[model samples]
Target: METLLSIIFIYIFVENFVLHRFFGICPFLGVSRKMETAIGMSMAVIFVMTMATLVTWLLYTFVLIPFNLGYLQIVTFILVIASLVQLVETVLRKISPTLYQGLGIFLPLITTNCAVLAVTLLAVRLEFAFIESIVFALAASVGFSLALIIMAGIRERLEMANMPDVLQGSAVTLITAGILSIAFLGFQGMLSL
Candidate 1:
């Protein structure tokens, strides 16, 4: 429907979790050094974000609110996110040792990624229906993946470009991220969602 399309567009381009809201900056910068690693991290993030959204939304709606235990929202959400990250870690370790190793600390760091937590909390706070929550989470994750891949590609190219010593390394990366953020900001008002 038009509403779903608006949700997807608004989250991906306008209110992007990474570029716009500035969540998950650690992995956004760390794993983005290589396209392969960025893709790996993005997949893990997408899985975790989507699953977390589903579980948390269900618990909040069916358990927490019904039981008048809404005060435990943050605690419950973190536990769900952390457990999901562990599942992802185990699966990645068994499936692709290279990516698992490449991700290193960043993979575990996804457990604490505010973006993951934010999506779940946002879905609940916005009172989104079950399907809307899934769509929102998927859109957010795709947006995050898009930003990560773009940053990785840019960083990879930047490694080859001749640049000043001052603007090299993290300096250039931060500058590039800022520029990308500004570009995403231009999407504002493009959609009313």
Candidate 2:
């Protein structure tokens, strides 16, 4: 139980895929201009990451290892993740046109998002249990969402604050992300398995 809690803490605060590991910076910066868009993307990511983890884990444990096909992990993982993204895109388009429009090109971009791929690959490499991998992926997705929402909130405020001409737009966003990453690192020694 302690190990589980530690994994949650580390993934959410210590090893956040965005602010800490820096996996999905493209959408982190591009789609975070609005709180709604950020939230939508986050929800979509959480769903995709968790689903991808589940599918990949089942495939690896049941099929790949059984047939000495371990070498095909990456290819198989990508196929699963891409299909999940497409399903998510379809659902979002039908359920919420506003969010669908807000997400724009970024929706399909999730297929190529490194964070999703990283979570799937890491879950297999780390040899997590069925439930453990689900939890890990969930924690990572929440961390990504937390980071994105925090950045969106900050950017909203930064828009209102006075700043020099040179430090506008992505310049300020990058600087803020740097500081946020350092803040996450401060969690060092806070939790350990």
Candidate 3:
């Protein structure tokens, strides 16, 4: 169980897909202008990533590897991720137009979000067990959300705060993300994972 906990902690803090792995920076910056949009995108990512991990692991473990079809992982993974994103987009549009609208392009962008693909690839590459892969994906999603929400909050405040001209817009957002990434590094050596 400690290993599972370590995996969660590793993905969530020690090696966050956004801050540590540096994946999915596009939506991390593009849609993080508002807390609502950020939350919406994050939730979408969480579901998409977790589902992608589960499906990819199942296919790789039982079907692909068993059939000696390991070479098809990339193509299959992309297809699965894209389908999942489309399903999510449809559900969000029907269930809550507000959030759907807030998500905007970022919703569909999850299809191309390397973080989703990264989790699946890494899970297979590391040869993690099914449960371990699921846990890792969940933790990575949470970490992604943590970063997005934090950036949204910071950007929200920055909008009202008086700052230098150069520090406005993406400039300040990128700087804030860099600082947050460094702050996450403080967790280095905090765990044995």
lDDT of 3 by residue, 114-174 (tens): 8999999999999899999999899999999999999999889889988899888889888
- Model 1 worst lDDT run, 10 consecutive residues: 98-107
* Positional deviation of residue 63's Cα in model 1 after best superposition, in angstroms: 0.8
lDDT of 2 by residue, 1-193 (tens): 7768888998999888998788999889987888887887898788788988999999999999999999999999999888877877888799988777765456677898899999999998988888889999999999999999999998888888898989988999999999988888898778765
User: Roughly what TM-score does model 2 have, to 2 decimal places?
Assistant: 0.90
Task: Tell me the TM-score of each prediction against the true structure.
Answer: 0.90, 0.90, 0.90
Q: For candidate 1, report its TM-score.
A: 0.90
Error of 2 at 141 (Å): 0.3
Residue pairs in candidate 1 whose N, alpha carbon or C atoms collide under 3 angstroms: none
Residue pairs clashing in model 2 are none
